[model samples]
Target: MTDGEPIPEERGAPHRGAVWGAAAWSAGVLVLLVALPWAARHRLPDPLATHWGGHDPDGSMSPTGAALFPAGTWLVLVLATAALHRFGRRAATGRARGATGAALAAGGVLLTGAQASIVHANLDHARWQDADPVGTAVAAVVAASALAGLLTWLAARPRGATPAGPRPTPGAPVMAVPPGEQVVWLSRVVNPWLQLTAAVLGVCAMGGLLAPASGLIALNWSLVVPFASTSVIVLACSSVRARVTARGLHLGFGPFGWPARRWSPADLESARAEQRGPAQAGGWGYRINGLGTTVMLRRGTCLVVRNRRGAEFAVSLDDAERGAALLNSLIARSDRTAVTHGDDHR
Candidate 1:
């Protein structure tokens, strides 16, 4: 087993232990959101204050509505994430799982905190409008939600993510560049599964962005902004283009290729073609597991590179052999040039 490879336990989707843990955690969160408000029903006003405008209450819902609203939203969120875990291209990956867990954790906290605040404010009030200002409580709730999300993300990160990988392969394929010849290799890969996921998120974001006009839900910029931003990011990462030239490897991302990464030949320790899969690379898209950073679109042949620090970076693509060969050749050429310069100076 190489240093960066996934162990037997890390290869598959939806581990049994993880499933049960998530279910239990979800149940706990649901209970907190529902039970707290219901338990305090006797003290709260018949119609509880829900939406606050500035310092005063501006919107209200029945005691039953108040209890069920946040809980219902939480339930929907849980179900959506559950579907994603079961069906998403790389949802089972450590990074994906951690992201899902973190979102749920933060959402659970926000829902439960809001419910608790509402119940507390409405206590001993004759009317929903008379409820005390909950600005401080709202701030506290947001802080707690953020903290919980961060903690969950940190806890779920893959353990022992050391920057170690397979040793440099001397037998790896290489291409020879003629003395004055210009060689450039271009390769691109697109993940339809990721594109589909991004499209779905984009549709949802569009709906959320327009929901305010519909007057169906109390949808606001706070919810729409993050959702839309996420959609854009996912769409941007759905496709990747790799270009190898005398300058080194240039990776362009998305259709427009706005965000890209470049690595000079001198910066790479070694380049090789390695057979890998989502199971081995810890799921799809961009990932960093024990295997280091992998821009894994689909699994199979990957152009893997190790920097001087022994840190590995990989990208799954077709004709990876040619790409790796060209990269390795460039590195070799750069090394020869450096050695020649050194000898001249001496």
Candidate 2:
């Protein structure tokens, strides 16, 4: 395949297990949420004290309604998350499917646990009046969500490297590497979860405005703030443009000339094409962890560049081999020019 073209992952893929596991885990959690509350229906108060505030039960819903809300809401969440992921996966060259699955499952667990805790706190007491339903609900959502995120992260462990078709060209310094060449590589990715999250938060934020006193404003704000901030942050990180100039290599978020990473040709250490799967980035696009910064716009071949400090920066682009070739060629040309200038000065 050409270097810039995404490697077709229809072959053996590492994230396959993670994706299937996500499907199973999400469905299982939803099932448990649905079944457990119904089984405990009889034990619950007739009109469950579903909402509590200031150490008093201020709001109540029929026990049947209380049980149904979490089940129904989470069911929709799972479906929406899954469907968005199905399309986003194709659009972005099969990236972040695991993360989308995990997020859906984790969100379901949090909502389910919140309902369960709120209901149980009221039911188990001799006087349902003593239970603080809202407090328990909030705490349960936070704690359970944290645990679910950790579990999802662990579950996403890389199974293996994705095979990128035939053996790649060696990373050795090629004598024919073109130097003084001008080249640009551009790529962009969309994470459906971000837009899905934005929609959910925007809705909740509006709901908060409807009844300012219900504490939903506070509750929804809590969710909206961080999620919105993260979405905006990654928004910049996901869309990228890479260029190899006479000066060096450049990476940036936009066509704007400002705010770009320019690597002086002298600092250029090595460039090679790497084949990776979603497992490598632990989901998708602009993943910056212990592995350094990975601008994964698509799967298959990527151009990874290392500087004098040994730090690696990678971007998934079409014709990665060609990009790497161009980078090395530029480095070679720069060195040759530097040497020629040095001899002339002497």
Candidate 3:
């Protein structure tokens, strides 16, 4: 590397390999899962279905298995594929490798669980359920445990070093900055857990409505409202702007949605980033409380500021410590400028 010479970007082949490998593995797993019940149905006598108390007296697979298994398997496989893409972007390190492996394993287990849930929920409906029920159940448990173990192993591996210094320590107070400098920051709304939960719930609700026993026409409406509302909220937070100027602070999110909130700079006092646990922080989203208002998801850093009225305004940002530092500098400068002008007037 020489001064003025552009450094060559590292190729992404290995990461790509990992991603593709994970995808292939997940696909194979899904295929095996689907094939198992079919094979068992053929091998065992139909009397086993009756013995197992399946809802289907004729030893036929339940509709639930057909629907949920494929859906869940596909969802997990997609997530694993995405994770592999992310993993490939980072330079390979022990930690990165571990994380990648763990993510893949978790994806597999979750995929399996999706299949198992489908089977378990409709066990009563399965005909010719197979003679060795205990053995089959044990195998499923062992497979689940193996998947979990792999994920744990990967998660526990050390992370690769970055050219950048260690990520800002979580919960550290942001350093202050001087006023009059324009600062920009980016935030993303990527909450897998929330999205997954909502999706599963929505799917279940839809399935219930379509089932023969369904009497609650209104149940589907209940499902649609929350599903739609969450989708809107998530979409809105995908991209947002928080600008601090002499006039005031402007906060806007989503491409076309309305701005969530805004406040005058005069009303803004000190700003700091705080690390809050999920339990304390209310699980993600724009949250307000006596201490102040905060926007966060899971466990990450957030920028919190005090208004002139002593109320706090907090926003979740990637690289939150840096954002908080920038905000602090701006507020300190403003305070000093105000004091200097007051002294001169006196």
Candidate 4:
């Protein structure tokens, strides 16, 4: 290949064991979700109470409709999550694969559980006029439990080691600006997509506030705070600067940045350049998927840095290989210094 050609990767096949296991869990929840209403069909009266205002149901629907909504939602979640799991697993590998699949499956299960609890609370042996028992605590408990389970599952799951990835070219570093004369490699990356998305959100919030309907205006007005705030941030701080200085590797907005994330040579174990597609990082922005933490701005070649604690930090930008090589070199130099100092002390 040419001198500047990017390294190719050995993107391995999906983990069928994890895929099937997650699918099975999703399917089980779906079946249970469907079965609850189907078995209780006889007990549920016509025009079942499906909507709740306070502790009691205020609105009603046909038993079949009530049953179908949750059932259908479960079915859709399972199918959609399964597809995401399959595609997500492809980009992820090892423990990330297992963790991602588990996260997806657990998320789907929690949704099903939350919905099931609300639905079950409404189920009773009488005609449809507020006969069912309900409470604020019950709803709160269900939500809290489901959230706890999701977090617990995520925490318990390992971040996993990076799989066998494509290797960087032997001598071709992406951005090896000779630090001999000048002592740093500095670059900037602006996220136009984030700006665009934030703009759209702001416009939607404005439109919602201007909406004729009172409820619509309330919803729109509610959005205005977060949307406008986020828009301002995106416009003002969407750009990130990567600097490799004498100290170590630095990434943030600028000298004093917004994110304020820095990695010292002593803190990191290794760094490597790899091709990071959108799927690999499990979406965009500062995402925390199975791969650990990713500061994704643009998708392409990126630097994956593994810290002493084994967590990975990834950033996608121009001349990623040079940055990675420089960081790795810095880490090696620091290690040698520490070893030499330790022997001298002895």
> Which candidate ranks first by TM-score, i.e. highest?
1
How many angstroms is residue 11 displaced in model 4 relative to the true structure, after the best TM-score fit?
33
TM-score of each candidate structure, all chains considered together? 0.50, 0.43, 0.42, 0.43
Q: Which ranges of candidate 2 are over 4 A from the true structure?
A: 1-25, 28-47, 53-55, 58-67, 81-110, 116-120, 133-182, 186-318
C-alpha lDDT score of every prediction, in listed order: 0.73, 0.57, 0.48, 0.57
Q: Ranking by lDDT, best first?
A: 1, 4, 2, 3
Residue 339 CA displacement from its true place in model 2, Å: 1.8
**lDDT per residue (tens digit) for residues 1-346 in model 3:** 1124332322221233234444554554555455434433433333333123333223433443553456575666567547654665455445555565565555555444444443443344333443223334435656765766574464234421111224445554444333334443333333444434433443343234332211112355666667556655654543344544444455666433245576644457766767675566665666676656666544666667787788776666555565555555556666777899999999
In model 4, the runs with Cα more than 4 Å from the true position are 1-182, 203-221, 232-238, 253-256
What digit string (tens of lDDT, one per residue) describes model 4 on residues 111-230?
444444444554554766754545653465457546645653543243211223353576543333343333344455556556455445544443343232211113545556787777
Q: What lDDT tens digits, residue by residue, belong to model 1 across residues 66-168?
A: 8688888999999988999888946556677778878987897787777767777777788999988889989988998899789768655543221222333
What alpha-carbon RMSD in Å does predicted model 1 have with respect to the real structure? 14.1
lDDT of 1: 0.73
Model 3 alpha-carbon miss at residue 207, Å: 6.6
Model 2: per-residue lDDT, tens digit, 1-346?
A: 2234443333233233334434555555555556545656665666667666666787776666776777788778777766775776564233354465457646865765665566556654544566544675577567867776665544332222222443236664442533333444333223334334433443333233222222212345665566556644543443455656455676765212224677877898878889976688666766776666787756777778888898888877555675576577777777788899999999
List pairs with backbone clashes in candidate 4.
none
TM-score of model 3 vs. true structure: 0.42
